[model samples]
Target chain A: MATGRIVIDVERCKGCELCLEACPQDVISLADTFNAKGYRPALLADPNHACTGCALCAVVCPDACITVFRDVPTPKAQVALEV
Target chain B: MATLTADITEKLVYQRPDALADLYTHYCPGCTHGTAHRLVAEVLSELGMQEDAVLVASVGCSVFSYKYFDVDAAEAAHGRACAMATGVKRVNPDKIVFTYQGDGDLASIGLAETMHAAIRGENITVIFLNNAIYGMTGGQMAPTTLPGQHTTSSPFGRDIKLTGNPIHIAEILGSIPGTAYSVRRSMHDARHVIQAKKAIQTAFEAQQKGLGFSVVELLSSCPTNWKMTPNEALSWVRDNMVPTYPLGDYKVHEELQSKRGRGR
Candidate 1:
């Protein structure tokens, strides 16, 4: 399975919950506390480690607050396989 | 299974496009104006036209659009964006000139200017935002407001007999001979959002090739004016707005038609 991570800029998030809806893995949720903007920011609350980092949340985000990254298999693993 | 760490070998998948300013926009929560701006910025960056682009921001909620885009931009009078864009494109024919206008400004007050620019084949791009209601003016009934839709001016629902009808800008503009490309897209869902981006990219390509006037009418939402949450407002656009303003390509020049259906 693809592994991934996301960074949410809390101050920039307006807490519209669009990222949560866009997260197919259901790994995102709104924080209980409010930010300086008085809006609850979305968090990468993945407990089962199920995030695939599809970037759907970032795509749907209107505020441009989410940054997404995907893990790449190490070259050492491919070298060992060839051996 | 292995635990994920921040230090893992990773590739960045998505981040803010360089064409957009690194500043907070004045748009409300869930306002699709930010989404539209982001898409435009992405397109400009992908086409490597950011340096040559000049944005003409129109009045309404998007009046501050110039502040959001990092490229050279100018603020135009209410309902005069097309006229100003025509001037800018004529003065600097080599530059990529475009106008960002709202329905009230494009279809209502500046209808004549918009049509004349298109009819003249001004070789400019127009990013038209149609949110149905006049957002900056406190949700008044706009020319694009749907029939029976309630607003500040139409508290009892808009009456078609009195207000006439909601204008289908894409279709109207597409019929003009000078219009090289005209299409309507929505920001209600991720799938449609992707399609909207493609349409925006095509509109810019039309201008880049000097095909003539191109406009992409984006059906956007106004959560504050609609008195609904951002998610609900998006659903409302899908359920209500999509029917009145159907999303499809109203026109495409024969040259551009060949480029359609190709994978990105």
Candidate 2:
């Protein structure tokens, strides 16, 4: 399984909630607190690691405040073959 | 059984457009200006016009258009963006020139400027944002405001007789023989946002080809001025404004007809 991370430019986010709705994994939501601009920034809650890293939230973000990154499992060590 | 160990590497899937600065814009929450800025920046980046664009920023909430775009931009007087862009495009023939205007600036005060620019076939792109109100000036009724639409100036709903009818800018420009491309799109949803970007691409391509005046009228939402929640404002655009302004291609140069569908 793949893991994903969301990076939010808290200052740039306008709390439009478009990204909250666009997140297929429902890991995004509006934070209870406000940013320096007196606007609520979007927060991610992937306690169960349900994020699939689809990037739909970033695609629909008007402010371009969100960036999505995903990790792919690297190859494992190979075993030597016996003759 | 031996456990297999592996490493994980993070890869970037999506990031902000480079044509836009890292600074936060001053637009109100839920306003489409942010989306509009993103789309224009994305188009310029895609067309490789980051260093070769001249943006004629107009008055209104978007008066600071120069701040959002990383390219060379100049602020134009109220309703004079088209005129300024004409001069800029003429002097810098190799650069991609464009004007980001609102309804109040383009349709009402700058009507003559916008009309004459299209009539003269100026080789420049015009990204017109029609929110049907003077968003920066406290929500006054704009020239494109629909009949019976309530605005600060029309508290009791717009009177069709006194206020006159809403102007169809895309249709008007599209009908003009000099206008090479014209279309209307929305930013209310993700799918339409993608479509809006395609429209921007086609418009820029027309300017790059020197096909003459091209316009993309964007049906934008003003959540703050409209006095509606952000999401409700989007629904209003899809349900209310779309009917008044509609959306589609009003004109396309014969040569660029095939390229229009390339974005799809």
Candidate 3:
């Protein structure tokens, strides 16, 4: 199973709402909580399950705000006998 | 017999630009509008703003600019492209905003919008194409139309007593305090075309940096209106229009280094 992560850089964000529209899975939203500049920054909800790592959000972001990372699980290693 | 491979130059001519849509343009052959579209499209691709950029096209031969550019676009009312672009930029500040207009549209009907946008220092790129005549509306006199130049409206040759002299839009816009960068260029020949691309890239870079208003005035040729072949039309622009609309950087902000400098 793969998990998705959404990271945002609040400082560079201009509150353009482009990522909000670009999110096809509707996992991204803008919270009422304001950043240091008093502008509403984008917030991600249910990121682990809802986001498919489509990367549309990253592509449409004019200020290049959001970055999506897909976590792929690694295979387990076999134990060696010490006889 | 020796095996021969296709030369890179031959491949270059066969490869079509991906940024431009596969549609037959309505512009006349040898019209500079096609070159202008290609330049803008290439810039959008180079900056990776193709998807995020929204172009506002004004009424003119460039009104169909939306058809050629692969990016998102909206057709504005005649001469209202600047006003529409202002709204789009404000609403979606992140997306690259641009307005393409002709001399008549920018210097005449949309004069107020153009002046205000420059004065307010809107962070948008305006591509002003000055062919000196109203191309789509027939060979009519335009604000940038040279003095003593005959058109359909000025069949007896433009008279200073009747029709006023050409307006230097780039120079006038450069005088405004809010304008960050402005350049007047031409596409009469290969050399001028290269210079024009540089001017256009600068204008787009200014917008990307969120700098104030940027305008690139291109003194284009109108062969149909001039009643000459493509070559003659280009020669006429070089000889006549260059004297009236000299090519150079009218204004640039020495203090601003780049986009990072502006943001800081």
lDDT-best of 2 and 3: 2
- Rank by lDDT, descending? 1, 2, 3
lDDT of 3 by residue, A27-55 (tens): 88877887766657787787348776665
Fnat for each predicted structure, in order: 0.71, 0.68, 0.00
Quote the RMSD, in angstroms, for model 3: 18.5
- Cα lDDT tens digits, model 3, B1-264, are 011111111111112346678665667646778768777776788778888989999998888888888888999998889889999999999999999999888998999999999999998899999999999989899988888898999998889877667899989999998898888988776556657767777888888888789999988888889898666787898899998887877788664434211100
For model 1, the DockQ equals 0.62
What are the runs in model 1 whose C-alpha is more than 4 Å off? A78-83, B1-8, B261-264
Flag regions of model 2 displaced more than 4 Å.
A1-3, A72-83, B1-8, B261-264
Give one digit per residue, the lDDT tens place, for model 2 in A4-77: 88989888888999887667788998888999998899988889888888887876787889888886654542
Docking level for model 3: incorrect
Q: DockQ ranking from best to worst?
A: 1, 2, 3
The most accurate candidate by lDDT is 1
Candidate 3 or 2, higher DockQ = 2
Worst 10 residues of 1 chain A by lDDT: A74-83
Per-residue lDDT, model 1, residue B47, is: 98
Candidate 2 CAPRI classification by DockQ: medium
